[model samples]
Target chain A: NAGVTQTPKFHILKIGQSMTLQCTQDMNHNYMYWYRQDPGMGLKLIYYSVGAGITDKGEVPNGYNVSRSTTEDFPLRLELAAPSQTSVYFCASSYGGASTDTQYFGPGTRLTVL
Target chain B: EDQVTQSPEALRLQEGESSSLNCSYTVSGLRGLFWYRQDPGKGPEFLFTLYSAGEEKEKERLKATLTKKESFLHITAPKPEDSATYLCAVQSPGGGSYIPTFGRGTSLIVHP
Candidate 1:
């Protein structure tokens, strides 16, 4: 059923370049999140959305923007990418924001900015 | 500030050996605790969620127990396939916030 899918599995961009990481879920979840994981590090929240048309910043949201124009898609845009932004990006979704609800994650998108 | 920390940044065990991973956290208010397993080049896969202290959950060879300040993931007789990075996260109880704060994961390697 393609639970959650992320596009451009791998990409390399130069400094000052821009790109968008695409994410889509078929579970009709109301909550979506974007996280970046550095090598040997944990996932850090970049941005999230409670529902379509509702977006909010999370920890380490700098230099990133997110849009939730549809129930199934939440894309993360990197504006003026920097070398520090080189990390693996993951997209996740949950049925609701309940404390017990588990999040389903997409494979991941590896981005490198040189 | 909310934060999570995991111990033994890396672990190596022989197949059929058992071990435990630690995840500690400090938050204003605890909403939930989550455990995930991440394979090379893949995203973290959900494993268990504990909402309160004294809660325990089990799946196959793994069992998770939560306390007020920490959680433990016990691996019983792990196999090579179980080698991966184990991550821990905590959700804050701040008003209407669901995003979780994650800790640097513990890397586990099982050798045959």
Candidate 2:
């Protein structure tokens, strides 16, 4: 089903630079999420979408933005990147919005901001 | 605030050894508890979900047990391939969002 896929498996950005982390799921999931994982830390939600056109902030949404224009695509935008943004990012999707729904995750993107 | 804490940040076991990883959580009301396994340089893979206290779920070589305050992941007869970071998370009914709060995770290494 292709499950969930993320683009740019690795990247390095300079301070003040911007980039978009792309996420797509072929499972037709109605729920999509963006999370960041620092070394030795648990995943922290950056943003999430219930469906296309409905997005919400999560635990750590600063310096990030998200747009879900289609059920299959959810992209996270980092504007004016900072060194603190250096972390591994993951994209996940689920069939429903309930907490019990199993989440399928993509191979993470390792980002380094200098 | 919902919080999850996994104990024994890391563990090393010889192949065929058995052990358990602990996850303790604090939340206003628990909606679900989840277990995921993550290999190095890869994303997390869902293992199991427990919706209520006293609930139990099992997969090959892994059994997850949930209580009112904590969850335990028991790995039976572990193999070297079972080496990975095991994560725990809790979900609370938060105004319908129900975002999960995750623990740092327990890293396990089984040597052949």
Candidate 3:
């Protein structure tokens, strides 16, 4: 049922450029998260939203911003993209905030900054 | 700081071979441990969840067990399609937060 979908399957940006990665979910989940995966490193949380209009910083939030304007969308923004920001980005969603709640993830968005 | 570590960064197995991947964690207050499978260029897919020590969960050829300090994902008679990265994550005791600390996944390659 198209659980989660991310746009721009791949992108290449020059240094100092700005871009936004789009993520949408059809499950009407209340919790959404943005994470980045680097080589040999685990997924690092970038930002999260508990619900529409509610957002919070996560473990790694530098050089990025997020907005949750609706129940079905959470977009991650990259301002002044840098080489360090080049990585595979993932968007995930869950029905609740409980520890037992399972998170469903999208395919992924690969971004490269030169 | 809450941390999660996985052993054997990469593993190569033949068809029908069985092996186990380890995930060790250190957190102030444990809530739940999660296992996920991720294929190359794709996001992680949920596999199992273990809430307490001595708890076990099984799905297909994968069996996940939890202890006080570590968790193991045992694959029995795995096939070529089982090749993927296995990730381990833990939810903290903090209320109203679903944030999970994740470990570098164990990349598994099963040859047919």
Candidate 4:
């Protein structure tokens, strides 16, 4: 089963260019999250959604936005991207509460901002 | 703010060697702790979840144990494929959100 899928496995963006990272999951999970992982750093949450149309800012939400129009899809938008935004983006989904369920992650989207 | 700290930024172990990684956290009220393994250029893969203190979970050559202030991931006779960065996260309630804090992670390299 295609548990979780992300688009544009690799991309290169110029400074100030905007792009969206697409994420979809087939697990019918209630919780979905967007995170960025930098070299030698851990994953940092950018935004999350509990269900459709229910989204919230996470630890590092600045310069990023997320929308959950449906349970199977959560997209992350980057406006006026900067070189600091260059990192591997990951999308995760969980079935139950964040504290009680196991989070399954997508392959990842490697973005390079120049 | 919730905080999670993992010990040993990097570790090198010989094949078939046993070792342990530590994940320590401090939060207002912890709901649960999670362990994940992330390979290079890939997202994290869930390993284990510890709900409360004195809990333990095991799979294959890895075992995880939790305590009030920390958690341990013990690897027994590890192989090269087992080499990866291990991340630790903690879930807690704050204000009205259930935000989890993550650690920098421990990078393990197993040599054959």
Candidate 5:
């Protein structure tokens, strides 16, 4: 079903450059999330959306912004990127919340900010 | 605050061997504990979900059990294909948000 797809499997950015990581789901799910996995660290949520037009910040959202303008798409924006933002980003979607159901994750995008 | 900790940062098992990976957590109130398998350079794939103490679930050669303070993912008759990083996550009730707290994960290497 192409559960969840993330664009730019790999990316490189300068310290002050900005870029948006695009994610899309074809499962018609109601929940979508953006998470970053640093080396030797667990995936940390950056932002999430419950449904179209509704979004919220997560554990590590200071350098990121997100928008869910459509049920199928959720985009995470990195502004004035820093080396700290260089991590593998994954986009996931679920039929319900983590407390209720399983989440499907994308292949992930490896971002390197120098 | 919700937190998850997985034990045995890395494990190596011989073919036909059986071992268990541990995931311990602390939370205001437990909603669910999840297990996922992540291959190198790939995102995590969901494995099992344990909602309460004494609850158990199994798939193929993998079995997951939960307790009030921790969860165990038991692997039986390991194979090279089963080698990967096993992650655990917890969902707490107080956040008003549904984000789950994840552990650093246990890297499993099953040698043939």
Candidate 6:
């Protein structure tokens, strides 16, 4: 199982620019999540999806949006990039929505907003 | 609010020197605690999960123990290859979100 995969390992965006981060999982997980990790900080949830066509905001979902069109794909969208959004982004998935389920993470995408 | 705090932000140890990393947390009705190891430029790999206080889990040279308020990851006779950033997280059963709150992580460097 390829586990989870993310695109554009590294990206640089200018102020006000918009982009979409793509994530796909082959494990057929029912839950998918997007998180950002800053230097000297823990991973903060940005958005999550419980299933296809069902999405919800996470802890830091102010400038981000997400869609789960298929069980294998969950994409995160940034409407307006800012310097504060520069960080490493990770996509994860789990078989279920319970706390006991283990999440499989992707390689991560490093974003630099100038 | 649920919070996780890890100590000794960074630690350097000689090969064969054992050490323990601490993760303290505060939450309402704890559901689970998790430990992960992350290498540079890669995503984190799950190590262990503890469900309740007094529970312990081990893999290879690493052992994780959980308590009512904290969790400890102990490395025994570590080698240089075992160096990585160790992260701890906690999940509560409240609010119906079931999201895990992670710690800043403890960076470990083993010198040969």
lDDT of 4 by residue, B37-99 (tens): 998878889999899999999999999999999999999999999999999998888654665
lDDT of 6 at A110: 95
Candidate 6, lDDT over the whole model: 0.91
lDDT of 3 by residue, B1-112 (tens): 7899999999999999999999999987787899999998889999998999999999999999999999999999999999999999998756558578899999999999
TM-score of each: 0.95, 0.96, 0.96, 0.95, 0.95, 0.96
lDDT of 6 at B66: 92
* Candidate 5 lDDT tens digits, B11-85: 999988999999989998788899999999999999998888999999999999999999999999999999999
TM-score between candidate 4 and the true structure: 0.95
Error of 4 at A79 (Å): 1.0
Per-residue lDDT of candidate 4, residues A1-114 (tens digit): 799999989999999999999999999999999989887788898999989999988888999999999999999999999999999999998875635667899999999999
TM-score of 5: 0.95
- Indicate the residue-level lDDT of A41 in model 3: 91
Clashing residue pairs in candidate 4, if any? Answer: none
Off by over 4 Å in 5: A97-99
Assess candidate 3 and give its TM-score to the true structure.
0.96
Considering the true interface contacts (CA pairs under 8 Å between chains A and B), give the fraction that model 4 also has. Answer: 0.64
Candidate 3 lDDT over A68-104, as tens digits, reads 9999999999999999999999999998676467889
**Can you list each candidate's DockQ?**
0.73, 0.75, 0.77, 0.66, 0.67, 0.71
Error of 4 at B37 (Å): 0.9
Q: What local lDDT score does residue B7 receive in model 1, on the 0 to 100 scale?
A: 89
Docking quality level of the chain pair in candidate 4:
medium
Q: Which one wins by lDDT: 2 or 5?
A: 2
lDDT of 6 by residue, A7-112 (tens): 9899999999999999999998998999999877878989888899999888899989898999999999998899999999999988765548677899999999
**TM-scores for chain A, candidates in order?**
0.97, 0.97, 0.98, 0.96, 0.96, 0.97
- Please, what are the lDDT tens digits per residue for candidate 2 over residues B1-66? 898999889999999999999999999888789999999999999999999988899999999999
Mark the regions of model 1 whose C-alpha exceeds 4 Å error after superposition. none
If both were scored by TM-score, which would come out higher, candidate 1 or candidate 6?
A: 6
* Clash count list over all predictions: 0, 0, 0, 0, 0, 0
Task: Compute the DockQ of candidate 6.
Answer: 0.71
